[model samples]
Target chain A: MAYRSTPLRIDRDHALRERILECALSRVADGGFAALTMQALAEDVGIATGSLYRHFRSKGELAADVFASASQREVDALGAALRGPGDPAQRLAAGVHQFAARAWHSRRLAFALIAEPVDPEVDEQRLLYREAYAELFSELLEEGRKAGVFQLHSPSLIAACLVGAIAEALVGPLSPPARAAREAGYPAPALDDVSQGLVLFCLRAVGVKELV
Target chain B: MAYRSTPLRIDRDHALRERILECALSRVADGGFAALTMQALAEDVGIATGSLYRHFRSKGELAADVFASASQREVDALGAALRGPGDPAQRLAAGVHQFAARAWHSRRLAFALIAEPVDPEVDEQRLLYREAYAELFSELLEEGRKAGVFQLHSPSLIAACLVGAIAEALVGPLSPPARAAREAGYPAPALDDVSQGLVLFCLRAVGVKELV
Candidate 1:
């Protein structure tokens, strides 16, 4: 794969770029997007404002960079969570659980960036993640179908809906209290049940026997 | 129907309150949320700032009120759109088309609210909209299930997916160029195809034959 074959060539000043993003994320976390100013970020990182500009093009660029890093971090984490020794169902379950955990942690930062100038780019990154996620599920469905363990009309579309359901269940255009409710030690039947039910529904929809 | 049978008396002041909301929607349409300010809104409605606060406790309250009105408007529209639908599948198609049109028209405001304060009370309006949308699809799915026009292991979950997919497809979340492309008249094959495939796959899943 091109991704696997791509050679690693880290820039020497990548540490500074990473530091800038960390400062911005911290600022955004502290007081939403209101706190993420160029001067404030540069001051926090102990660098001159002009020096900071050398690393990033503009405020919009900086916001875009921070979002890309955060998005890539999330996608990598989701990818790792889905890659396991278990059957397709187990892998999907692991992915959803891992996603909810991370989403709960970064809900504010994630939502903040959605209103930033970089939202369109973030959306593009999201499509890539969705495509990759769909591929993962489709393969599992194909495996199940071959083994007479799964049956569905279109493995790809089923995969899309399964992935879409889980994604939207957490990050619906509107707020889903499920994430915050679960984290606050509140009993959220809707959130917990939906996660469990989503996996079961996907299996059943694909013509698998009752999920275990 | 309670809605049709019950004619609640409209208070003059309450009617003015609604007038404020109606104008605010037009304002949000003309410019973005950035354009809707207390001063501008008051001026637009020929009211004093003090009078505005009388109806709304604060700016957030005003936003919530506006959101509630807009959300209800969408719900009523969805309900009306699906009422005369041909069959389950046809009704589903009509519902998805209606949803896409509404979401596209209100993209900016929807994006703003989605990323707004995670206030439960504030978001309740949107939650109502979500439920209203889901319910419409649920009815269509049930109609399809009964008429042997659709297949689904669980109509409820399928309905959720259908609504979620339409929303996602409109926003496509990460593809601004795609959104721009759509505006520039890149035909909505992805949109139409996805909705069609989902409904068909759903029907096949439950052992029903697809109807034109």
Candidate 2:
């Protein structure tokens, strides 16, 4: 009976932790990391603040977790697209389009993940995730180079450039100030414009023969 | 007499602040922001920590100032190269080459300024400095487009991509682990390799006619 109850307790704890992370992520998506207070997240998860601390020792740790989880999803999605179909160049273009489109649709979360000035812990995660993105691009670039479809030197370095360009390209339009300006009727680049620009920038960067 | 002394006092205070920032920058250059503790900075400046506090309210504020001053120098150097004599395409290549060369020379400081996990204040400065870099590129991009030497859409967006690409490309080769590997005789891309790769990436990204 004791062994059975121990497993049940472990299951309950795991579920609660997952729920807390989900709520924390939701808060961040809605209002960036600034909105993710312990008290608010606890209430959102129907838990006590003390209990929240029991799960996450500090806001930084929790924020880092959220950042990693969210970033992992993006990496996974981009990896799938880049590895999915068509030629390597087409796959690269599809990956960029999917990334920009997803980022545009969730402007706040994207901005938060990409450029929001937050805890150093989250920033650490950012560096790791940027590397993750570079890895995915490097794989595709190697494939393209081998196929003679992409003319490039140092595929790893080129991959890093692609990661940087794509992230920086999206940071502006998704930023809060830009969001406010758009809401106030100022001119801003639409998703299609950003997506198209990024795709061109990346394809040309990798030395796609046709684009060049 | 009071007014005259007031001016002298203000001059002395300003000089001390500059000295403090110099020391702080040196610390960051040697060991990244992790070595930029307020107490260590005070000792470096031969002043009391309390006196340092009089100059900067907090460590974050001090780090931001250091970040700004260092970033401003890079921005100024880059601006000169980008706005210097030659066609827009030539200037663009020269700028990328110069920027990469400078970062390679000051690997630690460049890493700190470019992608360090530091206080939120420093992160804010990073975002602002990135915009400054983008503005310089945007100006040249517009010039290139008008001169019919470069074919691109959305100079602003393309400029951001260039900024991102250049920063990201250098971050890898300049990072601490990369530095350690290089020092230990690991095969890492040399400065020329990175600079040339980055220049090619940027030129192609902006649609330089010859490169294409």
Candidate 3:
């Protein structure tokens, strides 16, 4: 009976861990990584601070976990868009458009994930997730090249450029200062304009046949 | 006599501070930021660790200063290349090639500056320097667009994309693991190839015609 109960206890621990991650992710989505204090997260999780420590050793460790989970979601979303139904160029445009729209909607979280100054651990995750994004773009780029829809010798290098271009393009408009400036009625590019400019820049860079 | 002595003491302190920063930059360039420690840096300067703290309150502060100084040199160099004698397209290509070549020659330092996971203070500096780079590109992009040599609606946004693309493209090739893989006989993109591909990409993206 004790042995059987051990399985149930492990299940309970796993469920509790999942709950903690969900709460932590929400905190980051709302206020960037700065708001993800272990003490506050413990209160949100309805667990003691000591219990939180039991699950994650340090704030850096916990933040890295949170960063990975959030970034993975983004990677998955981007993957779906890139692999969706269309020609290579169309898919690329759709993916870039979807990515920009999503980031525009969640400006704070997107800024946090893309360019926020945070723990080194999160920065490590940034590099990993960037590689993941590049891989997805690599697949589409190679396909585009083979289909004669794109003209590029090195797909991998160009994919990395796309990842960087997209991130850098969104970072400015989504940043807090930019958002504040917009709130104060300062002129700023709208989401459509940014998305279109990025699509054009990427499509042109890849040597697409014609620009629509 | 006291007043006169004060100026001498101030001069000595300033000279010592400059020496400390130069030593710190060398340490970072040689081994990335991981090799930068207060004790080791003090030893390199032939001073006590306590004296090092008198100049820099913390490792992060020292690291950030080194980062800013090193990055400023790159920015200045790229600026000279971009603002040099050429048409918009020629200048852009020249700047890209020069930037890539400089980074290739100093892979480790370039990697550290571009993508190493380090202190938040340094990360903050990264954002600032990236802005500096983007601003430089903005000037050129706007010039190109006005000259009808490049076609782009938003100079600033496209400038950010170019900055991101250049940094991202180099980050992969310049990363430590990639370096090790190349050293171990794995195939890697040559600097010339990268420079040519990057120049072509930038030129095409900006609507530069008749690629020579």
TM-score (C-alpha) between model 2 and the true structure: 0.96
Off by over 4 Å in 1: A1-12, A28-35, A109-121, A142-148, A172-191, B1-77, B81-162, B169-193, B200-212
Clashes of each: 6, 0, 0
Q: What is the TM-score (0 to 1) of candidate 1?
A: 0.56
Can you give the lDDT of residue B46 in candidate 3?
100
Residue A72 of candidate 2: its Cα lDDT?
Answer: 94
Chain A only: TM-score per candidate: 0.70, 0.96, 0.96
Scored against the true structure, residue B176 in model 1 reaches a CA lDDT of 44
Q: After superposition, which runs of candidate 3 have C-alpha atoms over 4 Å from their true positions? A: A1-5, B1-5
Rank order (by DockQ, best first)? 2, 3, 1
Candidate 1 backbone collisions, by pair: A123-B173, A123-B174, A124-B174, A151-A206, B151-B202, B151-B203
lDDT of 3 by residue, A118-145 (tens): 9999999999999999999999999999
Chain B alone vs. reference chain B, TM-score for every model: 0.72, 0.96, 0.96
- Mark the regions of model 2 whose C-alpha exceeds 4 Å error after superposition: A1-5, B1-5
Q: Please write out the lDDT profile of model 3 over residues B1-212, one tens digit for every residue.
A: 45564788999999999999999999988999999999999999999999999889999999999999999999999999999998989999999999999999999899999999999999999999999999999999999889999988999999999999999999999999999999999998899999999999999888778774
Estimated TM-score per prediction? Answer: 0.56, 0.96, 0.97
**Model 3 reaches what TM-score against the true structure?**
0.97
* lDDT per residue as tens, model 2, A128-210: 99999999999999999999999998999999999999999999999998999999999888999899989999998888879
- lDDT score for residue A11 of model 2: 90
